[model samples]
Structures are given as structure tokens and as C-alpha cells.
Target: MAGIGFELRKYLNDDSFTGTLKAYGFAGLISAGPWVLSIVGVMLIGIVALTQPVVGEADGSGVRQFTTSVTWLMGASLVLTGLLQLVFTRFVADRLYEMQDTIVNANLFGAMALTTAVSAAIGLILALTLFSQSFAYEFLMLANFVTLGNIWIVVIFVAGLKRFKLILYAFALGYGATIVLSILLLPFGLSGLLAGLLIGHALLLFLMVGVVLPEYPVTLTVRFDFLQRRLIFPSLIAIGFFYNLGIWIDKILFWLNPGTSEAMIGPLRTSLIYDLPIFLAYLSIIPGMAVFLLRIETDFAEAYDGFFEAVRGNATLQEIELLGNHMVSAVREGLFQIVRVQGATILILYLLGPTIIGWLGISEQYVHLYYINLVGVGAQVLMLAVLNVLFYLDKLRDALLLTSTMLLSNASLTWLTLQLGPQYYGYGFGLSMTLTAFLGIILLSREMDNIEFKTFMRSRPAQEVAA
Candidate 1:
């Protein structure tokens, strides 16, 4: 998102209220637009289903099944491709840095092909063996799963480029088609909805590829040289895996726990008590994410580059430390801003949450859970910002440890909450994130204080070798 952030920050040049609004609005849309479309679009489809069920069923069984299938599809895709997300991003960044442009497009195709093969193989296994659904449903789902995974990889590439408007347009058109086609096909039941999804995503994938592939010349041979031993960053791989796992582990625990969840489909269980509130709470993070992408990508990135550039150049100790201090302050201020922004958003949501839940026909009983998850989501955003800063600093070990902590704490504490009963349900996720974010802040502060020493010391061996 460094590329996206750089483009968005140009709005700040105005330094007016309108400018700030533009910056945030664009950021929110760019960052979370797809999310808004998915949530709201699915809800609309559900509403349509509620009003009139198909000929066979009185209830919106099709809608429920469709939603469940999609939920699982997204979960499986993200977790399956988690390692590639960071590792490939790092590969592209390095190749770009080294001015090896020709390597990028082919490697990207290689990655997409790799992601498709893996996701398809696993998806086919699960779709065939685990699911007892009709062949059409399974085939549609397998296709959608493969497309979504490929889309995720393309997003990583296009996000690194500055094609913000094109990205938004592809998202809008593809999802727009999804909603229209899904509603039109709703009468056909689950397979139809899934078919709608497959088409929309296929188009979206094509458009996304257009944005990226046209820019770089295509190389004849597909390359998987990125998987070579020297190019791999195991710490980054672990960080991506653990972080993605950590975020989902609590939800998985809830779903698999017999006490909390019931079977939704073959091998898939869902916790009605736990799922809705957390999903809604995630929507509340758009503002924080917008702010997050801005500060981290712009201010913190600038400071980071300055400090490192100063070190690599002929800057003296005093000069380097002064820039280091700037970088430290950037980190402090950025984290604080995220907290303040997300805190306000949380408070507003708290006051209005009951009404919102009522509007959605959700039980008022889930209100407390929603509020708790709100804070958890906020803490996760803060953790994400911290992780981004850590990544920029190349503090991969710290990142890996923090992600591991989140996974362990969320899993264990969530299990404890289940034992403690309904009132404590959402506390586990909230508390885990809060604990991790606070720990991250402390670690970051300490790391910033000693970065210069470590930077110079680490370089000393290379310096000696050169001499």
C-alpha cells in the first residue's frame, strides 16, 4: 500500500478540512471499498431472499447456504495464500529496487499460476471429498475459490503500482455485476448465486490483471526463481502466516467449539452468537485503516527512509540520531493518532450500535458482544500499524513473536471464554489484541531507541570485509 498511500497523501498538500476529508475518503474507499460492497451487497441479496424464497423452500435457505460457502471460501483462500502475500510482495519490491523490471511480470504470472494450482488442488479435494453438495455447486465454488486467490495476488501487484482509480473501477464493476447477477439468479438457489460470484470475480480478476500486466513486458518463460533459497525471507513468511492465523484463530475456535457453534454445512461450523458481531465490528475499522495506511505509508515511511538513507550516506552520529529521533516520534504520533481516531469511531458506534443492530434485525442481546468486538477490532488495527512499522524497520523476529502471541492468546483466551459462558464471549479476542498491541508499542519504543547502534554494528562486519 506504499504506492496507494503515496498517491493519497498528495491530497494533504491542500492542508484544509476538505483536503483531509478527501484524503481519508479516498483512502477508505481504496482500502475498504471491496469490503463495504461485499457486506452491503450480500445483505441486499439476503434481503431479497427474505422477501421471497424460491419455489421449494419457504425460508432463504439458498441465501444462507450461499453466504456460508462464501465465508468459508474467503477464509480458506486467505489462510492458504498467507505466506505468498508477504513473500511475494517482498520479492517484487526487491526486484523493483534492483531495477529488474523484466523479472516482475513473469514472476507475477508464476505466482498467480502457483496460487491457482495450490488453491485449486486443495479446493478440489475439499469440494469433492468433504462436501456432499451437487456437482454444480462444488464446481462453481471451486472456480470462485481459484479466482479469488488469483485476485488476491493481483491485488498485491496492482496495490504496489499507482493505479488507484482503475482498481476502484474494477472493484465496482465486478461487484456491481455480482449483485445484479446474484439477484437475477437467486431463484435458481445456491448454485446460481455461486455462479454469479464466479463470473464477477473472473471479470474483476481480468480487469486487475489488465491494470498490471499491460505495464510490464511479458517474459516468455514463467519463473519460480523467487522460491530460490536466497530470495526467501522465512521471517516474513512466518509473520504473514502467524498474523493471518492469529486474526482468524479465535473465530475458528468459536466455530469448532461444540458448545458455541453448530454445523452449518459439511465440515463447516458457525457460531451465530459469535460471528455477526465480529463481522459488523470489522466494518467499523475502515476509518482506522484509512488513517493507518496514510500515516504508516507516508509519515513513518518517510522517516524510515531518511534514517536509513542518512546511515547509508556520510551522515555523522549527531545527524543520524536526530533523524532517528524524528523517526521515533513519527512512530509514536502515528500509533497515537490511530488510537484516537479508532477510539472516537468506537464511541460513536457504541452509542448508536443498538439502533443499528435493531435495523439489521439482530438480537439486542448481541449488543455487548458488538461493543467488545469493536475494541478488539480497534486493537487489531493498531497491531497492524505496529506490524507495518516493524516490517519497515525489518524487525521481522519481533513481528513473528507478536503474531505468535496473538494466535496463542486468542486461541487460549477464547476457549476460556467459552467455559466462562455468554457474558464473556467476545472478551478473549478483545483482550488478546489489546495485550499484543501494548506489547508491540513497548517493543517498538525500545527498538527505535537502539536502532542506530544495531544498524551500525550490523554493518561493521561488511565494512571490515570491504576494507
Candidate 2:
């Protein structure tokens, strides 16, 4: 991500206002494109399903079912892929650091094949047992889940490389095809919608594979050495799982709670009070994400590399200290930039809340919820920046603890809010993230202060003796 940020920053080298805006604008789009596209695609499907009677009433039953399936598929696939994402990223990073490119592709294939098989088995069982829908619906749902899972695995690899443009193009094509196909097959009802999504996702997976294939030798023999490596950090697996869980835990609580949710399809449920506002609020974070990538990846990353290079080159202790301080300052500046940009963005969206909600034809009640959730997601972006720095600092324990707290707090607080009623709905998410960000800031500051001591302590015994 930092590499991509640096690459994009090159476009803004002229330093003109227009150039800066264009660079950041493009970065924001690419950074948030997949999420924004998914939301738009789902909303479009809902709109079309409402207008055309697709095996359900105009009251949005069919739309609800289609959207519900999509939501579930996304949640499930993300959870399934979460563990693999961090673990595989670590493996790939290590392999690349060692310049062993051939194994990277082979292991990726192995991981994909493993994830696909697991997703298919689980999806098939769930579709068969839980759904009781027609064979077409079941098959399409299964296919969609499997394809989405594979797409996520491919994304892990693609994101590790500098293929942001290819990724953007793939999602654009895939979602565009989905919209067109869903309309063409509208008469076929929910099954048609699912089919469209499945086909689109499959195309996306194929394109991602195409981009990644050129990076390594083609090998039929699959290996799981990365997964099997004895030295792999167990905390990484936990952090991956907990972080993804934290993000979705509140939604899950809402969906399952009787007071806030209703069944949309099969056993799946949607929270009327929580979903739309949160979704809309998330869209507001594009600016923050763009700034995050730009600052952290470009300025902070350069400082970080310089510090390490200085250390490796046997620079004077004072020089190393100065470089370290520079890196810390860069991180602080980057974080501040994120907050400033995102705060302004939140304010703008809050001011425009009514106009935007009115244009969407949603009830005015949603505006307040939208305002609250905007702050929540903004805080989430801040937390993400903190976590990125923690990772760079090799503070995996801190990252794990932060994510764990977020997961527990989000789940418990969201449940409490549900009991407290509608007025408190979005507060749970917002408050939890706000508290987590506060803690992260403090921890990050302290960690940066003692970074040199920590580095020395973590070095080899021989190096310690020499020192």
C-alpha cells in the first residue's frame, strides 16, 4: 500500500493545486473503489428489483432477499479469508524479502485452491440445509460465496504487488457486468441476481489471477510450506480474525437481535436501524483513506526506510537518533493529516446530510444516524493508520491487543445499545472506535519514544554482546 502511495505521489510531483487534487482524488478512488462499487451495485440491484416485480411484491421482499444474500456472502467470505490474508501476506513478504519469487506463486495457488474447496464445502452444506430454496437459488448462492472467497484470496496477493490500476479496472468491469447481467436476467428473479453476481465475481477472480501470474514461474505442484512454517506468528492469525470480526461484529449483533432485525432470506437477517446509515457513512471515508495512503506510504515510509538504511550503514548514534526522530515526526504528521482531512469531510457530510438523504429518498430519521456513523468510520480510519504504524514498528502485540479490545467492545456495546433502544444505535460503534483510537495514539507515542531501546533489546545476542 505504501509503495502504491509512493507511485501515486509521483503524479503529484509538480506540486500544483490541481495536480495534488488529481493525485489524491485518483488515490481515493482506487483505495475505496471496491467498497464503493459494491455498495452501488447492491443499491442498483435493489432499485431495479423494486421497479420490476421479480417474484416478490414492490415492498422490496425480492430486493431484500437479493441484498441479504450478497451481504451474507460478503461477510462469510471475508471471515473465511481473514486468517489467510494476514498469514499469506506475511509469507509472501518474507519470500519477496528473500527474493524467492517462484515459491510465492505456487503457494498462492495452493492457498486459493484450499480456500475454494473449504468455501465450496461449507457453502454447499449451508445452502442445502439452511436455505431450502429451489436448486437454482441454492446453486447460485453457493457459487457466489465460493467465487467471492477466491476473489478475496486473489486480492491479498494483488494488493501486495503494485497492481492497483489493474485491480480498479477489474472491479469496474466486474460490477458493470453484474449490473448489466442482473438487468438482462431480471425476469428470472433472485436466482438471476445471484447468477449475475457469481459470474461477475468469477471474472474478477480471473483478472486478478492474470495480473499475479506474471510474477512467478508456472508450477503445477502446490506447496503449503508457508502455512506449515514453524516460526509463523500465531498472533498474526488472531489479529486478522479479531480485526475483521471487530469490523463486522456490531452488524452481526444487530442482524441477530430480534428488536433491531428481521429475517430477509432463509435464516439471514438485516438490521433496518443500522445498515443503511453505516453503509452511507463508510462512503465518506474515501478522502481519509486517500490521505492515509499518501502520508503514511510516502512521507512516513521514506523516513522509515532512511532510518533503517542509516542503521544498516553503521551511522553514528546521533545520526540514527535523528533519523528515528524524523520517522516518528513523519508518522505524527501523516496521522494529523488524516484527522484534519477526515474531520473536514465529516463536517461537510454532516452539513449535507439532509440534502443527501432527501436525494436518496430515505427518511429524514436516517440523517442523524448517518452523522453519528460518519464520525465512527472516521475514527476507524484513524485506528487503521495507527495499526499500520504499529505493524511497521513490529508492535504486533500492541496491534493484537487493540483489535481484541475493539472486537469485544464493539460486540458488547452494540448489544447494550440494542437493549437501550433506537436513539443509541450508532453510538456503540462510534464510541468503541473512538476509545480504541485514543488508546492507539497513546501506545504509539510511547512505542516511538522507546523504539531504539526496543530495537536493541530485540537484536541478536551476538549483536547485544558486541554493543
Candidate 3:
């Protein structure tokens, strides 16, 4: 992504209105397009399903079953894959840096294969034992879950390599087919819809596989090098798991709490009051994501590279320190830019909360939660930027601490809020992110302030003999 930003800078250099749009447009596509398009695609499917009415639904009165199933699939898959996603990402980075590019694709295949088996086993257990649905529904659900897990792995692989154009086209075809096949299959009932989802994502999986295949044609042999103890960072695994768990723990509590949720299917449940606002608030992060991509990748990345390069090249302390200051300034400016953009977005949403809720006809009661969660996820972008910088600097301990704090805080506070009352419904998750961001910013500031010592006095390179 940092590399791709240079190409985006080319458009911004045009310095025209159209050029500016092109730059941000490309950035947004790279940052927000996948999830945004996915959400929209699901909404489209729901709207179309509305036309014919939900057929074969157990309740026959609500449309929660299909959506709930989809939700569970997404939530479970993300958390499950979270363990390896960051670890694998780091492996790829190290391999690329070492110019061992041949093994990258083979390792991805290995990872995908492992992910598929794990997700399938989990899905089968849930489908067979816990969830009581028809055989077709269960099978399709399990298949979708496995396919979606593979998709996440491939997506991270491609997106990390900064294949922006391929990402755009791939998502376009994939989701386009999904929507079309879903609509076409809608008439066949929920089973048909599930089949559509399965086929569409399967198409997407194949497309992504095809895209990366040529890049590493050395061997597709199943290699578990990533799992080797020496190369794997347990802290990274913990960080990934904790970060994703923190994000979803609030919603999970909401869905499972006896008072807040109602059983939907088998043990699965839904929190009508808590679900809408947060998902919608995620869409609001587009502007902040765009800004994050542009600033962190372009401005901050250049400064970061310069500082490191100066260090390795034996530059004067003054020159190295100057570049360090530039890097610090870049991170500060980037974070401040996100705050400005996302802040403005939140303010606008807060003001129009009522109007938007009224427009959606979901009840004006959601307006409060909407406003709170907007700020919450807004803070998420800020926290994520901080984490990215820490990861780049190899401050894994600090990164793990922050993410662990996030998980603990969000889980405890959200549960506490639930116990308090509906009035405090969204306060917990929102506040947790704000608190994490606040702490992360402080940590980053301290690191930047100590840049000189960290570079010169801290741990020396492995091959260097300390004085």
C-alpha cells in the first residue's frame, strides 16, 4: 500500500480538480472498496429478496436468518484467520526483502489450504451440531464460510503487494457476479441465495488465485515454513487476534446477552437495537481511510524511509536527527489530517442522524447509537494508523500492549454498558477505541521523542559488535 501511494501521488501532482479526485478516488478504492462494495452487495440482495418475500424461512415473518448466517460466517472467519493473517503478512515481507520471491506464492497456497481445512472443520461442527437448518442450508453455509476464509487470505496477499488495479477489477467482477447470481437465485429461495453466495465467492477465490499464480510459478507444493517457530512471532499472532476480537467483542456480547438479544436460529441470535448503527458507521470511515492511505503511505512513508536510509548510510547525527524529526512530523500531520476529515464526517452525521434514520425508516431511536459509534469507528482509523507505524518500526511489544488493552477495555466496558441500560448502549465500544487511540498516540509520541536513543543507544544490529 505504501508503494502504491507513489503511483497515486502521480495523479495528485497533476494539481487539478479532476486529478485530486482521481488520487483520492484511487486511494478510497484501495482502502475501502472491498468492504463497502460487499456491504452494498448484501443490501442489494436483501432489497431484491424483499420483492419476493423470504421463502422457506422458519419464522416466515423476519429476514434475519440469511443475514444472520452471513454475519456469523464473517465474524467467525475473521477471528479465526486473524491468528495467521499478520504472521503471514510479516513472512511475506521478510521473504520479499530477502528476494526469496519464489516461495511467497507457495506459502500462500499452503496458508490457504490450511485455512480452508480449519474453517471447514469449524463450519461443519457448527452446521452439524449447533445450527439446526436444512441439509442444503448447512452445507452451503459451511462452504461459504470456507470460501470466504480463503478470500480473506488472498485479499491480504494481493492488497499487501499493492495490486490496486487488479483489486478493483477483481472485486468488480466478483461482487457483480454475486449480486447478479444472488438476484437470479433469489426466486429459488434462501437455499438458492446461499448457493449464489457460494458460487460468487468461489469465483472470486479462483480469480485471485489466478492473479497471483504467475508471479511465483516455482512450486505450489504445500509448505508450512510460515509455521516454523523461528520465523513466527507469537506477539504478532496475539496482536492480530486481540485486535479483531476487540472490534467484534462488543457486538458479540450484544448478540449473546439475554436481555439485549433474541434467539434467531438455533443458538445464533441478533441484537436489532445494536447492529445497525455500527455497520453504517463503518461506511463513514471511507474519508478517513482515504486520508490515512494518502498521508501515512505517501508523506509518512517517505520520511520513514529517509530516516532509516540515513541511519544505514552513516550520515551525520544532525542529518539523521533531522530526518527523524521529519518522520515524526509526518506521522503527526497524518494523524491530524485523519482527525480533521473523520471529525467533520462525524459531525455531519451527528447533525443529520435523525434525517438519515428517518430516511432508512428504521426508527429515530437508532440515532443516538449512530452518533456514538461514528466517533468510535472514527477513532479506530486513528488507532490503526498508529499501529501501522509501530509495526513498521518493529515495536511489536508496544503494538501487542495496545491491542491487548483494546480487547480488555472494549470487552469489559461494553459489557458494563449493557448492564447499565439502553441509554449507554453504544458508549462502551466508542469509548474503548477513543481511549486506545489516546494511549497509542501518547506511546507514539514517546517513541518519536526518543528516536535518537532508540536508533543509536538501544539494541544494535545482530552482526554489529557493540562498543
Instruction: Report the poorest 10 consecutive residues by lDDT, candidate 1.
Output: 458-467
Instruction: Candidate 2: give the clashing pairs.
Output: none
Clashes of each: 0, 0, 0
Kindly report which residue stretches of model 2 are placed more than 4 angstroms away from their true locations once superposed: 1-7, 229-231, 460-467
Model 2 alpha-carbon miss at residue 153, Å: 1.5
Native-structure RMSD, model 1: 2.9
Q: Candidate 2 lDDT (Cα, whole model)?
A: 0.84
Per-residue lDDT tens digits of candidate 3, residues 227-343? 988778798899989998999999999999999888886788988788888899999988898898899867897898899889889899999888988999999999999999899
Error of 1 at 73 (Å): 0.5
* Cα TM-score of candidate 1: 0.93
Model 1, 329-415: lDDT tens per residue?
888888998999999999999999999889977888778899999999999999989988888776777988899999899989988
Listing every candidate in turn, what is its Cα RMSD in Å to the true structure after a full C-alpha superposition?
2.9, 2.8, 2.7
State the local distance difference test value for candidate 3.
0.85
Candidate 2 TM-score, true structure as reference: 0.94
Instruction: Give me the overall lDDT of model 1.
Output: 0.82
Consecutive 10-residue window with the lowest summed lDDT within model 2: 458-467
TM-scores, each model vs. reference: 0.93, 0.94, 0.95
Candidate 3 deviant stretches above 4 angstroms: 1-3, 54-62, 460-467
